[model samples]
Every structure is written in structure tokens, then in C-alpha cells.
Target: MTQELIRATIETLEMVTVSSLFSVLLGLPLGVLLVLSRPQGLRPRPALYRALDAIINVFRSLPFLVLMIMVFPLSRLITGRATGTTATIVPLAVAAIPFVARIMEQSLLEVDGGVLEAGLASGAKISQLVWTVLIPEALPALVNGVTITVINIIGNSAMAGAIGGGGLGDLAVRYGLYRREPVMLYTSVAVIIVLVQLVQWLGGYLERRLRRDGKVTASA
Candidate 1:
């Protein structure tokens, strides 16, 4: 039982890691694009911004389960299977990307307008302003948003298990539900709690470090 639990836990973490990483990798750029191209935002393009915003909203509005099923064909194309750890990553990452992107866009929006104005006044190019001023200024908020996204991903990983994606959640469904094993259910719950706590702690610590660095930079 212990060995099986350990293996399942590791597999769960691996799926979560892959899904979350891909989501971040894709979402960050999309978020940056959203912010930089909004009409009232940094770059301000009407048509392009509206189009992107619509796309983001569409994905965000869909339920995860529906989204997962909707993407099954694409998942099979990419992973060559509609079920398993690798197969689950496709939909998990797909569902997470827009969510993280929206969070990132909001974080970018929270940056002070005055700082952006100052950068503009100083003749910074759009790209330069984004890289040097906007992103750096919003780093703390961005980090927090990323933490939130990661936690969401962790929780959503369980949903992946429903589609035959192997993980702790799959174990729970198989043993706890099908076999009526209370031990498996309780064990999976405990592992999820530990994972969430660890993520929260790391996020808080990093947020503080970024804040401290921002303060030191402002002082200097």
C-alpha cells in the first residue's frame, strides 16, 4: 500500500509539474501581449486587443471538465493517448493557460501608471519599458498570481485522473471509490494538503524576497 501510494504521488507531482510549466510558458507571453496591446494599456491597439480578449474570455468561461473533453482529439494527436499522465497534461495545461494569462494581465495592470509615464517620458521603447519598468515593477504581484495559478493547477490535476490520467486522484477513484478503501481516500487527501501548503509557503517567501528587493532598489 505504501509503495503504491508513493508511486502514485510521484506520478501526480510529475503531471502537475509538466502541466503547470507549460501553462506558465504559454500564458506569460499571452498575458504580456494582452497588456501591451490593450487600447488603454501600454501599447493600445483596438482590434488586436479585442480579438485576444475575446479568445481569453472564451477559454476562461468553459468548465474544466468540458474543456478537457473538448480537447481530447488534440490531446490524442499530441500525446498519442487520451488517457495517462502525459495525456492529461494537454488539457490541464490548456485549461490553465488562459487562467494564468488573465491573472498575469491583471497583475501587469496593477503597476503604477506614473512609472509607465516616466518610462515613456524618458524615451524608452515599448519593449524596453515592458522589460525594464513594467515587468520589474509588477514582479511581486506577478509572482503571487503565478502562485495562485500553480495551486489551481494542483487542484485541477485531480480532474485529470477522472479521464484515466494516472495520479493520486486516480488511485483514490480506483481504490477508494471502486474498492471502498477509506485508507486510500484519506491518504490522497493528506498528500494534496501537504502539496498545497508547500506551494503556499514557497510563494509567500518569494513574494517577500521580491518586495524586499524592490524596496532596496527604490532606496538605492
Candidate 2:
């Protein structure tokens, strides 16, 4: 039992890590694009902004369970099957990208206009201002946003288990609910709690460190 649990835990962590990486990779750029193309942004294009915003809203509004089922066909197409960690990555990444985008938009929006002006005053190009000024100024908030996104992904990964994406949650559902194994259920639940706490703590610590670095001021 112990060995099985350990294996399950390792596999589940691997899936979560992969899902989280994809989410960040896809979402961060989308978020930056959203912010950069907004009305008050460096280059404003109403049509483009609205179109992207609509896409983000469409994905963000859907419940994870519904989205999971809705994307099954796409998942199968991408992974060549619709069961296991690889298959689950499709929906998990799909669901997370818009979420991360929204969070990232908000984080970048919090960046100080004054800092941007300063960058422009210093003859920095628009791209340079964004890369050096906006992103660094928003680093702490963005870190927090990323932390939130990862935690949400962890929860969603559990839902993935229902569709045969095996993880600790799947273990709980199969052994605890189906087979009435109370010990297994409780153990999985405990593990999830610990995982959540660790991520939260690490996120908070990183945010604090960035905040103290003083490289960029909140109003800069």
C-alpha cells in the first residue's frame, strides 16, 4: 500500500508540474499581449483587443468539468488517446491559459504609468519599456498571480482523474469512493492539503522577496 501510494504521489506530481509549465508558457504571452494591446496600452487596437478579450472570456467562463468533457475530442487528437497524464494536459493547459492571462493582465495593469513615462523619457523603445519597466514593476504581483494559477491547476488536475487521468485524486475516487477504502481517501485528502500549503508558503515567500528587492517601486 505504501509503495503504491508513493508511486501514485510521484506520478501525480509529475503531471501537475507538466500541466503547470504548459499553463505558464502559453498564458504569459497571452497576458502580455492583452495588456500591451489594450486601449491605454502602448499600441491600442480596439478590434484586436476586443477579439482577444472575447476569446479569453469564453474560456474563462466555462466550468472546468464542462470544459474537460467539451475538449475530449481535441485531447484525443493531440495526445492520440484520451486517457492518462498526457491526455489530461490538453484540457488542463486549455483551461489554465485564459485564467493565467486574465491574472497576468491585471498584474501588468497594476504597473505604474509613471515608470513607463520614465522609460520613455529615457529614450527606451516601447518593447524595451515593457520588457524592463512593466514586467519588473509587476514582478511581485505576477508571482502571486502565477502561484494562484498553479494552485488552481492542482485542483483541476484532480478533476482530470475522473476521465482516467490518474493521480492522487483518482486514487481516492477509485479506492475510497468506489471500494469504500476510508484510509486511502483520508490519505489522499491529507496529501492534497500538504501540497496546497507548501505551494502557498513558497509563493508568499517569493512575493515578499521580490517586494523587498526595491528594483521597482509600486508607483514607478
Candidate 3:
């Protein structure tokens, strides 16, 4: 039981890490596009923004359980298996993409409009404006978003056990539920809670560090 719990913890971490990375990679760009396409955005295209917004909303609207099943075929096609730790990565990422995109959109939008205007006035390209001004300005908030996303991914990964996605959730189900081991169930829940607290602490630490560094840099 000890060994299995350890393994399950590792699997859960792997799934959460990989899925969050993919979410940021794809969702960050989508979010940038979403903001840029907004009516008051850098490039303002209402139609494009609306379309993108709708797509994100549709995906976000689906329950994670349903989304997991819905993506099984795609998972099979990509990972060559529809259920397991690795295969679960696909659905986790898909579920997180829209979520991360929205997080980034909100973070980026919070950047001071004056900064964006100044970048524009300085003849900076849109890419430059984003890379230099917007992202930097919103770095702390973006970190917060990432932290939230990581926690959410961790939670979803627990649910992934329903389909044999190997992790603490699966371990809990197999032994705790199936074998009727109350100890295993309670232990699994305790471990998950501990993991979440650790992640939350780490994220808060990073955000505070970033904010402090940004302040120092600006003052310098």
C-alpha cells in the first residue's frame, strides 16, 4: 500500500505538470489572440474575438467527466491508448486549454492601457509590445493564473481515475473503493490535500518573488 501510494502520487504529479505545460503553451497564444481581437484591443476585430470567445466558452461549458470521455478517441489516436496515465494527459490538456486561455486573457487585460499605448507610440510591433510590455507587466498575475490552473489540473487528474488514468485517484478507487479499505481512501485523500497545499504555497511564493523583483527592477 505504501509503495502503491508513492507511485500514484508520482503519476498524479506527472499528469498535472505535463497538462499544465501544454495548457500554457497553447492557451497563452489563444489568449493573446482573444485580447488582441477584442474591440478595444491592440488590433480590434470584433468578429474574430467573438468567434474565439464562443469556442472557448463551448469547451469550458462541458463537464470535465464528459470532456474526458469525449476526448477518448483523440487520446487513442495520439497516445495509442484511451486510458492510462499518459493517455489521460490528452484530455487533461484539452480541458485546461480554454481555462488557461481565459486566465491569460484576464491577466493580460489587467495590464495598464497606458503601457500598451506607450508601446504603440514607440513604434513597437504587436509582438514586441506583448513580449516586452504586456507579458512583463502581467508576469505576477500570470503566475497566479498558472498556479490556479495547476491546482485545477491536479483536481481533474484525480477524477481521471474513472477511466483508469493511473494516479492517486486510481489507487483510491482500486483499493479504497473496490477492496473496501477505509484506510487507503482516507490516506489518499490526505495525500491529495497535502499535495494541493504544497502547490498553493509554491505558487504564492513564486508570485510574491516575481512581484518583488518587478518592483525592484522598476525602481532601479
Query: For each candidate, what TM-score against the reference?
Result: 0.93, 0.94, 0.95
Residues 1-220 of candidate 2: C-alpha lDDT, one tens digit per residue: 8887787677678777887888888888888899889998888887899999999999999999899889989999998987787788888889999999899999999988888899999999988887888888898999999899888988988877876888887888998889999999899878877888899999998899788866544534
Better structure of 2 and 3 per TM-score: 3
Alpha-carbon lDDT of model 2: 0.86
Ranking of all predicted structures according to TM-score, beginning with the best and ending with the worst: 3, 2, 1
Task: Give me the displacement of residue 77 in model 2, in angstroms.
Answer: 2.5
Model 1 stretches with alpha carbons more than 4 Å out = 213-220
Backbone N/Cα/C clashes per model: 0, 1, 0
**Candidate 1 C-alpha lDDT tens digits along 1-220:** 9998898889889988998899989998888999988888867888998998999899999998899899999999999988888899999999999998899999999898998999999999999898899888888899898899888988888877866888888888888889999988899879988998999999988888888864554422
lDDT per prediction? 0.88, 0.86, 0.92
Mind sharing the TM-score for model 3? 0.95
Residue 180, model 2, lDDT: 98
RMSD per model, one decimal: 2.2, 2.7, 1.9
Clashing residue pairs found in predicted model 2? 115-220
Residue-wise C-alpha lDDT for candidate 3, range 1-220, written one tens digit per residue:
7998999999999999999999999999998998898999989999999999999999999999999999999999999999999999999999999999999999999899998999999999999998999888888899899999999999999999867999989988887778999899889989999989998999998888888854544421
